[model samples]
Target: MATQNPPVADIETAQISSQTAQAGSTTGSWANGAFQKLKSNLVFRSKWAELNGAMGDLGTFIPIILALTLARDLNLGTTLIFVGIYNFITGAIYGVPMPVQPMKSIAAEALSDTNFGVPEIMAAGILTGGILLVLGVTGLMQLAYRLIPLSVVRGIQLAQGLSFALTAVKYVKQKQNLPKSKALGDRPWFGLDGLVLAIVCLCFIVIVNGAGENLRRGCGAAREGSDQRDEDGDVEGRKSKTARVRKIIFSLPSAFIIFVLGVVLAFIRRPKVVHEIKFGPSSMEVVKISRHQWKRGFIKGTIPQLPLSILNSVIAVVKLSSDLFPGKEFTATSLSVTVGLMNLVGTWFGAMPCCHGAGGLAGQYKFGGRSGACVALLGVAKFVLGLVLGSSLAHILNQFPVGLLGVLLLFAGIELAMAARDMNTLEDAFVTLMVTAISLVGSSAALGFLCGMIIFVILSLRGWTKDKPFSTIWTDRSTPEQP
Candidate 1:
């Protein structure tokens, strides 16, 4: 009987080991198969430039989306899926590196509270979207676009751009208010995501940007060398070698590399995050928005969001797209229609409310996003992450190095701000600067917009064109000898 008991125990242990090994093998095989399929399909599929371009807007997207996810106002997976679909659809339709960003005003309002009342956010989004859709379909958006001065639009862009830059700087300096994440509030200068690391990343980006110019120069130099070879039969030497090296370096995706490095660092810092990941997507639910929530959402979130979306999202984005892609005709109506539809469908399911933004567009374009493929691929990545990782991404994102993000955000901000450079005239500059200043000072885009409109109206009424002097408003004969 004792010998039989020993055999039974041994058999049970063996059975347990076999089951564990089989389970492990099944998971390993599934992962290997997926990776193999992906690699096979990507042989001729994803271009390095497009892949690089795909990460361009992530600096802006990550912080906002992460904040919302942390606050529980937005579901990480649902938001990603919705925004991902939006990106893909827009990419296919617009064929440009179009941007879809969280509605900043609503996000701000929601994030101001502790829990952010998801229903309120949804209500605000639905209302705002409905209004935008009405305006777009009826051509009222076009009318609004025509009414707003270019200077005012540029002002909003300048403000948003500069604001992004300032926030990014804070993120880099590690002085941002986030005391919970990676000693950021302490402003550490020596550790991972420290000031030193940030500076290095910034320098790398500069070199990468300069490398493109160098490549151009190198190509020209190579051509010259070719010509010289043809003329004098001289062989190319150091310059050609340098050009090839620079090309190789630039071929390495700058944004993606840094981003991946940050993510890797995060995982290294917290290995147990692997165990936290669940296999399935987060559960999606229909949020219950009460009448009270709707009213509150309207008053707090919608009112503020409406002006920002109308001006920045629709008007400024249209202006920017035209300027950036001169041949592309992006209309305010189309933009409004898209924004309206995005929220109308997604927010009810607790997805983040989103809109177009000039800053995001400029940032993406400034990086490497020349075509829709950049964002389309980005969208696919987002959808996969959503379906696979779900809210587990929150922990990873929460751990991502803020300093690296800051460097990305800084460049994006500068790129967006550069768009305002075309307004070189005095009156236009005055309007743009004032709008930006007031917006930053008041912390209110609506207020700054009002101030900008007032200034523009006064200037327009006073005949404040380049040739018209301020003193000439009352005088039939104004002084013009100063030039």
Candidate 2:
């Protein structure tokens, strides 16, 4: 037996080979697991879902981009490219359709103030980004979140929704023709085809969303009934699948269809507008800044945006992400980091100021995006368009019906406002409504936040001895468990 045994050297070589093979197998498995996560996060075959998600920010994106480029002389190339790249990165990292939108306060200020130029815009973005980075790294976001009452945050959201709804209504009316006596300028009486089309689109959205909800409820009821019978599992599963498919088909591309229909209608009805478009490479130049410009930008651009950014971009985004994608936790700190990073990097290259908006998230979720694949797809589209169609975008968008765009905004606003309904108690609702009214009337998030804080302090002092302490208002610890 000893003579038959393999030599020691041969035995050692065999052992080494076996070990190598085992190690290779392990490495391969690890690589595969990582690749699978990437695939799941970034890739999907659902074209409709991707398109729908892309449509979510069109309302905000279109108006802001156009206003910046046309009205403020902002560089379209830089804005689109930076935004597209940032969106792609965000999608890959977050695995959700978390949107990157312009800071509305800055945008409004920049658009309104003729003196605010590239330098001011850049300063504002850089300063905001720096502040956000500091907040994120220092964990101040959580501290801030803990300091603010949930009702105050809810009120900001409610006010933003109402404002957007009003804007949508205005857009619809903008397209409508008025009587000769009531007409503003050269407007004709009782005729504007886009308004009719927009009405149809709105009706379609309502019907589809309503039907999808009804179908889901019916399936849920059926499942409840099936729980009594052991063999009904398969039948229930089949029914669920059917309902899901129907819902997806109906609800997923509703906004996109409306948008595309608008474009098509525009082209058919107004080919001249399309013909005027000039397709060419976009011309962009670097932005220059001064100390004085930086100072003004910091005050007007950065300060006004701080409250909204903290509440909507950081706090509301975290809440919405938690609600829509349970177990996929997002934090105020992480959001701040991204927002800061994007602005810091983007401002250097002449990009528009950007942030993660709660409204954009609501809009995306209202569509069929459960995964980042939706935004990833959107990113790809954005990059391609920015590179290939940047110059012609203005003309193309000009042809697109504004009223239809309004319909999209209308729904997104509704979804965002609906999130406020989570505040159940009457006292909370009253505080939120007060904040909403103040925000709407004052047109200021900072003002709304201040008013809410003051109201909360008064309420706390009035009932300081209650079993539910005033401090509970600031802490989410007592929040009723959400399903």
Candidate 3:
């Protein structure tokens, strides 16, 4: 009897041959299987990895950065609770798992303009959330999407990224004790401490990447050799080796090592740190609001926030739709409606205002947030955190050094900056850069967005005027028509 190839093998072979012919690259089922397994492990089983990765992404970084920046202005206790709540809601709606804290731009404005106390703000948040819920239920959120233009929306996001990067640098400078140094008549450069921190963080990132690469190479080598032995023996041996290696690596507790090193370095240097960094409260404290106070404050606070929240939602949808669904007829109205509803539901349970967070949603998609289920997982994590340890979360976040936060944020900003470069035209790129610059200079994301929009409008109007029928009379006959 002639030996025949198994049906599965035949199908796989055909697929591989087709792909190889089309792309000049060979792929095997074994490799696909390994990748699928690794992906599954990273997403489903590895909570720490998921958390860290989410936090490291722009979505988490933006809120955390904001939190750190506005630490002095806002109540640490209230902010922590707000973050947990916000994260829970955004994670659910956007299908991106990450914490959303107080937006520094909004917080600063609130601090300056709103006389409402922390309790009142919390109440207002509750009301704003209710409004969102009503809008969502009524399906009005979708309508909001139609109102905003993609260019303006993205202009704001790009501006936000610039703002974040500039703020990170500022924070780093402050922490490093770098001065304007006008007295010395020397051009400003990185302070001694800032330079040291930057070098250390860079080294840490490089080391981590190197270690990961080495592990991957080792795994590949082991896989290549596994077929030499009896099929079953080879598989079992390979599995054992993989498990052992993974176990050793995972059990090493690298975070502990970094912490130890930091402690040791601090003790040895005893250098006078320029800025006093406060991470969070020493302990979690839950302050209960009376029913009367909650009711009165909620009404007073929420009414003002509704417009801002709506504006935020509209801006977010426009930007997201532009990049994710470019050239497609994305209904801004529909997105706004969806987000509005999500916000309403989220706020009822003490969540923060839910809008389309540019960084979180974008980062989640970048990190493989493909479906609602993935976003649901993020929501679940946030919900759990909020319900179980809302207050204490602040304290935990506070423990991270400003330098580390700055480094993480800097990386996130760089990622956004790179993404901005994908714009099709120089005009768009200029708009993005200019918006970012204004936002950073003013130290306000919202204001930066407003300025960018103003510029966009002015340019758009100019283009319209030039395109008018009468303008043709003044143009040279030899000049080609403008697109």
Candidate 4:
């Protein structure tokens, strides 16, 4: 027996081998599970998903891209690559058609201020990202969400929707005026080429939405049918499925088709003499920050955005995610962290400050994006465009008719506002209306939140508010005195 126990080292070697095998098995099992989950979640069955996902942030993207490239002279390639990478990561992590949008306050201020440049924008982004990262990591984002009333959040969404719709109308009018331009020459409807396309796209959207509702009703009716009518129920269900498939196949690609047509028309009118696009790695510029730049960024850029980020980006987006995709528990912490990380990484590369947006979420969800594949597809497109087109992206996008973009924006805005339809109580309606009014007038979500809070405080003090947590003086009068 002593001889059989040749060496203790041999026993240890066998044990190590066994443990290694177990670990490998466990890792393989996990990998398989993750692969299966991803497969189930990634849906690219329809063309509309890709189109909607790309268009989700066009409202903000168009302006920001132009501002940075045309005005600030930032490297367009680096900006797009940053956006693309972040978008892909967001979609992969969330497994939903979530959005990565430019920070509106930062973008707007950066574009408008002659003094503000890439350095200032980067500083602002870094500052905002640090603030949000701390908030998310420490769990203060959830606290902020709890402190605000739902009605106030709804009001913000409403105000944003109205603003987007108004912007869409302006775009439509601009396209309408294209006919009068001498460059295009005199044509019918003043050469309002994009208007017709916009109308067609709008009609397609309405039809698809209507069909979705009908399919739901048909399924319900079929389920309610008697066992004896099983055959008829099966026939009805099949019809609905066929109709849905047809709608998906035909309507989903309308946006891309229209975009392509616009590009073609653009080339015909003014052809690109250059035969080839230069392909190269994107440029990343170093941000040079000064004390004055830091102060300006903090005051003009980061401070104003703090309220909106809390309300719209975190709270409102979380609510929309739950409403649109039930069973998904989207928390403020996750969203805040995502926004912070996006900006922190993107700004260093001279990308625009980016964050998750409620409007973008609504737009993506409305246009048939059930899973992350929509966003991933868009990310791939953007990444390729950055690599291939780079600076020429402006020319390509410019060729896209503004009127079509308007139609998409209008629908997205409607989807956002429609979310507030559930606020039926009289008090909630009043609060929402007050907040919307203030936001519309001020053109600032932060101002609206403050005004709403003040009004709520006043109403609470007078015992006129619905949410009364404190005991009134009159109620205390009826209580017995303490010993």
Structural similarity to truth (TM-score) of each candidate: 0.82, 0.80, 0.55, 0.81
Per-model CA lDDT versus the true structure: 0.80, 0.76, 0.47, 0.71
Residue-wise lDDT of candidate 2 within 1-483, one digit each (tens)? 366878999999999999999999999999998788777778653566566767877877777777677667777766777888888888888888889899888888887787888789889989999999999999999788778888998999899888888877776666422111122332222333446666777898775554232222221122222233323656654445555455444544677778778778668767787566655546666667888999999998999988889888998788878877786878788999999999998787688999999888877766556567777777777777777777577666655666777788888898889888878987799889999999999999789989999998778776765646665665656577789
lDDT of 4 by residue, 163-232 (tens): 8888776666554232121123222333435455567767875654433322222111222222324446
Compute the lDDT of residue 394 as modeled in candidate 4: 65
Among the numbered candidates, top lDDT falls to: 1
Return the clash pairs for model 4, or none: 179-190
Whole-model lDDT, model 2: 0.76
Which regions in candidate 3 have their CA more than 4 angstroms from the true location?
Answer: 1-51, 57-99, 110-116, 130-144, 176-195, 206-314, 321-356, 362-396, 430-434, 437-483
Flag clash pairs in model 2: none
Clashes of each: 0, 0, 19, 1
Residue 205's C-alpha lDDT in candidate 1? Answer: 75
Q: Candidate 4, 100: how far from true, in Å?
A: 1.0
* Alpha-carbon RMSD of each model: 17.1, 8.2, 14.6, 5.7
| lDDT, residue 67, model 2 | 66
* Regions of model 4 farther than 4 Å from truth: 1-31, 45-53, 175-188, 192-197, 210-251, 273-277, 456-483
